[model samples]
Target: MANREYLKLDRVKGDLIVLEGVEGVAYGEILEITLDNGLKRDGKVVTVDGNRVIAQVFQGTQGISTSNASVKFAGKPLEIALSRDILGRSFNGIGKPYDGAGPIYCEKKYNVNGRPVNPVSREYPRNYLETGISAIDSLMTLIRGQKLPIFSGNGLSHNELAAQIVRQASVKGEDSENFAVVFAAMGVKHDDADFFRKSFEGSGVIQRVVMYVNLADDPVIERITTPRCAMTAAEYLAYEEGMHVLVILTDMTSYAEALREISSSREEVPSRKGYPGYLYSDLATIYERAGMIRGKAGSVTLLPILTMPNDDITHPIPDLSGYITEGQIVLSRDLQQKNIYPPINVLPSLSRLMKDGIGEGFTRDDHDEVASQLFSSYSRVQDVRSLAQIIGEDDLSEIDRKFLAFGVAFEKQFLSQKTDEKRTIEETLDIAWDILGILPPEELERLSPQMMEKYYTQR
Candidate 1:
């Protein structure tokens, strides 16, 4: 019935297009705009106040003449084209399939934005999404329906680690309805895009993957919408299609940068580091979209990667990100400088949902113990290193001697891994075997007997 009525356009400004005379017009109304060329562009209401709404033109409003064009609001928000057909496909920041593939064979389109999982709707995340990596699974375990951010600095190998997790992570015995990785890369270059494509294809995980890219050469404004579009598609597949989805957002710094650019274009008031004031809530809108919705057969997990500008955690983007997301896996600049591959600095890194996702039958019984032990050992290594700088490694105590070896084993064993390598939960656990070798069996009080016998090979 709402489709029969229409509202007239009041004005159009930079990033803000206004419509007049419709109290309760609502936010994000899907509309069809008949442009001059007779091509109807599909757009949505972006901002609304007392019936006046502003819509962002996804296709770029070049020839959209006010007098010529008619608007038809479908009385709803933007929805995505989603289904099994979305698999192995590529789309722009908006959800229009562009891989030379025809229209998606979908049931129906759903709203791009949806409500977050209610506190009552949330079930305890007991199932472990085994990442097949020692550093992650054995220490900072990733749980299903959890938001775990990867904190990486510029020029680090975070991208490679993200890609590998997509390839290697899965749930045991649930092979059929396992992971579907929704990878969104915003503001990356053509070469970076190509590298991800090639790496994903070579790994043969491209089939279960849906990628929405806003490259460096593309429209910068598109970056803000890119993750939303990817999540839109992800939501459809995970909930409706009944598949566990892992939504990866690489370089959220790029997304934030795009936001700053648009805000500057509009001459909006800037906040810290020239970012918008509502940056935290804006990020929460995306990151919180990930979770297990009540009664839904599938879940959407998030692993958003952010590059701290100048490796500064205090930077607005990574700072607000730390506040919004559950926990972060911080990659170390010093370890990277030492030629370590992942260089995930263990002490600072944490997974808040680790306890909920590990232990008992989910992973091994000894998982928590081994993880805590590793944390203690590595943390002491830092203390030893600082003292060594003051008094040297030679003049250290017996306990300090063990810490030195633990530090080396941590880097060579825990952090470094072949990019081409894919380890199972067992193999990753085996690396735990080598790291625990530095401390004596009595000092390894955290590990259980089966774990000690299986992993603690006597030196």
Candidate 2:
């Protein structure tokens, strides 16, 4: 049968065009809506009831009248053309080329809704991916195929941290040659998008970075597809081209908000905080995409950044995300007020997969012990600071005073660094040792005798 064009629409409401008496319409199938003015817009089938269908127009439903618009079903789902050439390009939220470069040569096209990696086919994630940041490399190490989210807050420096990771991230050994980055920015301002492009270009890493940007002024519907387009590109590069891909999605809160808006437009039942009921499973579809497949020579690592609403980690967005991802890197408002760059609060930040990634072969032999000692020693510093607040610091015990000094040095020396500065794993470990040296050798209970003999020095 020929593609039948329905000449009448049942209703038009807030980006949704509903049609009645529609036949053979499958969910997720593409649609072409032509208005009386002869202008056409793209849409996809979102809901299908008996002889009634609801489709979301990618562009807003403005200027579309129910009697004047026509709908034609396209027999395929939304897809983006993929190839090796997309590595250095930039695209809009819906995978259309945003850069001046022409359209990509379509070697193959991939559906944006990617299939989840099979549990049985997934290889245990191993080996560390270095971000060249001391706080992360020494304490919360990001494994190659793990999904580690950065939990930040409004007005913090998460954008700068994300750019720094894009510039300095690398795979160890000869595999470094195959490392690439996929950066997707959703609901960012025009200036923020410019900063990312310029930063990547200035660092001379743009050639290895693929960017998908969705500006704040763009359609909210496009924001919903931005990360999916990014993931499709990353999946192509990693699984098809045999390259290690690091996918960085910034401001996932914007994505979640867009999801909520669309859900409200559909008049769907709301869950916690007025978000859609399927928020957890919706997030899992994206977060669960990162992994290593058995017999495949590549991996996809995800680092999604979301700003907690009012610094409330219990907010539905961050709360559900924490349940899906491997671990989190929580940024601190207190540290940012002190002018720290990354502002990562080490106490709550953790990487559950760090144990298998760091060792004698991956980063360094003392990585595990150094990380443990840093965590243990820092916890004591917090206690000492609390005690000093009640009584005068001058009246504190000798060890307590030393802990105060150690805390100060730890934040300024270890956590704070230039935005452009890059440190190797070796240099990061050395700095950790230097900070640990502030305390008496006998107080270092986390470190083994052998590790202490080589790295520990009393200052």
Candidate 3:
């Protein structure tokens, strides 16, 4: 294979450049750009139409001239070096070491855009991943190999929740030792990056974690690559090394915005909210990468955190994501206003794989019952509260008043917790029992007779 350098540049649009006289350039092939001033940048071939090749430069085109700049086709796709040593290290979105650890030289290098796992080879996600947060573990349970996203709005505590999950998330059984984390932050602020680093280091889980950060100041092109790079490392860890890898990609909204930016620069037809039409399929490429491979001892579970634009759940980014993922963990602005730390609304949020993962051998025998009863009871609380506003609480029935009280206790005791506090599945279930005890045994209709006999502890 020969590396060919082309000097005939056609056009330059922001970070994208067009080159004619290119032969055999593959889509996603790595390219090297050399400016007239001797500065070099890396780019990837995004499109190839006959002899016309379109490459997106990782570094924006600020000081490059069409007649003077040159491009070299690397004849291969973008790849990241992968090995067991990638653990406990940090890299930029493009997989260059960012934590002062020099370039990683390994025997294996994986394409950043990993090959999708075949549906026939996928194993059912059947194990629990306890995040140590009561609001999630007790209600919307996270399972290994599931793509569960966090739907949040601006100014909510989503970042804190993400950090907490990374800090406290663990496997329940003997396979705990095989757990590792791959965290990717796209278009996040400097302080937010520092917060994640500090949180991970403080929790002492930094050793089992690999981080890829694309800061707000970084080129938008890299934001597009951040999650892919992180997923590549996760695939290496999970499939090759047999470690259960949790990949957390935060602020996917930013990643989508970057995609839209590039689409606009390329003059492509836009879809809903000016996003590209392929948004759904593009996102699926990332989310669908999460799952268990048949006969493989490891799995990849995705916890993508994306903030809704103007808190609109129907926005294209979240709407398309919800369609692809197993379920969503929705944060509440109303609850956040009330000072709830997690602010996870149990009614709207769900874990489709929770049933397959919990009860008996997974977490606890009472987990399913307790979660269902809490949701039912809290839903009634919302109804009673709405009624109280119409006809004052003083005029309401005693049961409605008890429902109101239960709601308050549920949020304070069951939902809200200190940032540093970590609760086991048993503790989360016990808290649910204590909160459900406020209502009469008849009110707990969701629980079975066996569940009631064992876990129901009412006064």
Candidate 4:
């Protein structure tokens, strides 16, 4: 269909503009709204009902008048130009270059609303992706093509942790040249955006990174498009260029809030916590995009971070995310109070795919045994600490005292690491062994006789 123009504007509601007598306008189709003063704005068709349509202006509807505004349907959805040159470039929330660089010279543009990968074409994710953090690498190992999210709260150090992962993450035996990162920040402040950029640039990893930033002051509608743009670029690089892509979307809560705002504007009924009813399926569209296709040479791994309100894990955002994602890495406020850098509370954290990704051919043969022992020992430590609080510490038994000491060493040495410190898988496992040795031989039941003789005895 040819592009159509309409001079009728029914009303302006919040950031949305309604039009009557609009025909052949499809959902998600782009629109060009020109004001009487010749200032033009971009919008997308959000809701259509026969001859009536509702669209959201990308800039805003502040000065749009119902009598003078002109609506022209672009007959296309929101799209971004994709190419291998997108690496190391910075773009706005809508995928327009903001790095002082000119436009991307590309022959093809991809729709930001990507199609879901068919379940039949998905390959089972295997092989660990190392983040160089002991708490993550040894415990909740991130597998290629897995979607593992970080559950955090306000004022925590998740930003630093995210930047650190981007700088240090790598795949075992994979060439550094084939590894790339796509970082997207939604509803972030100026200072926070600067921190991410400066951290990556200072670490000299910006060359392999693609950044998409949507500041808090920008239009809230743009937040919904930020991650989609990042994912589009990632798919292009991973599937077309054959490069492994790690997509990190920080503060997904902001994106959900944007959706909620639009839903409210459209008078849609709200679900849990005043969010839209389709929160689960909407989130799935983004999270489900991470995987390896059967015939594809590369994969896409997602590490989405969301801050929980009042540290409530049962809140709708994190609750729904846990259901869709493979696993989560939870950050502990209590650990942060103890001066831990990453502050990962490993007790509640897990990686469902770690079993298939580690041991024998992948990581070390002892990786599985060592990880199990650490989990069991740490769980015992928590029980011991609780018991000591009820009774006096001086009255505790020798084994109980050993458990408390092991807990301290585990947190201080194993879980906590400098922001810039990068530990190899071997080094992380070695540290686990050193901490586990504090327990008596009887307490190390998670390890087999062979692993005990090989690693435990040597320690």
Model 3 misplaced regions, further than 4 Å: none
For model 1, the stretches where C-alpha displacement exceeds 4 angstroms are 1-25, 31-43, 49-53, 61-74, 175-177, 263-268, 445-455
Q: Give the TM-score of candidate 1.
A: 0.89
Score residue 456 of candidate 1 by CA lDDT: 79
Cand. 2 TM to true fold = 0.98
Predicted candidate 1 versus true structure: per-residue lDDT over 381-439, tens digit per residue: 88899999999888999878987998898889777887777677667666776777878
Q: Candidate 2 vs. truth: CA RMSD? A: 1.1
Number of clashes in every candidate structure? 0, 0, 0, 0
Q: Write the per-residue lDDT of candidate 2 for residues 377-443, one digit (tens) a residue.
A: 9999999999999998999999999999999999999999999999999999999999888999888
* RMSD to true structure for each model, in Å: 2.9, 1.1, 1.2, 1.1
lDDT of candidates 1 onward, in order: 0.79, 0.92, 0.91, 0.92
Worst 10 residues of 1 by lDDT: 1-10
What would the per-residue lDDT of candidate 3 be over residues 385-408, giving only the tens digit for each residue? Answer: 999999999999989998999999
40-101 in candidate 4: lDDT tens per residue? Answer: 99988889988889999989999988988998898889999988888889999999999998
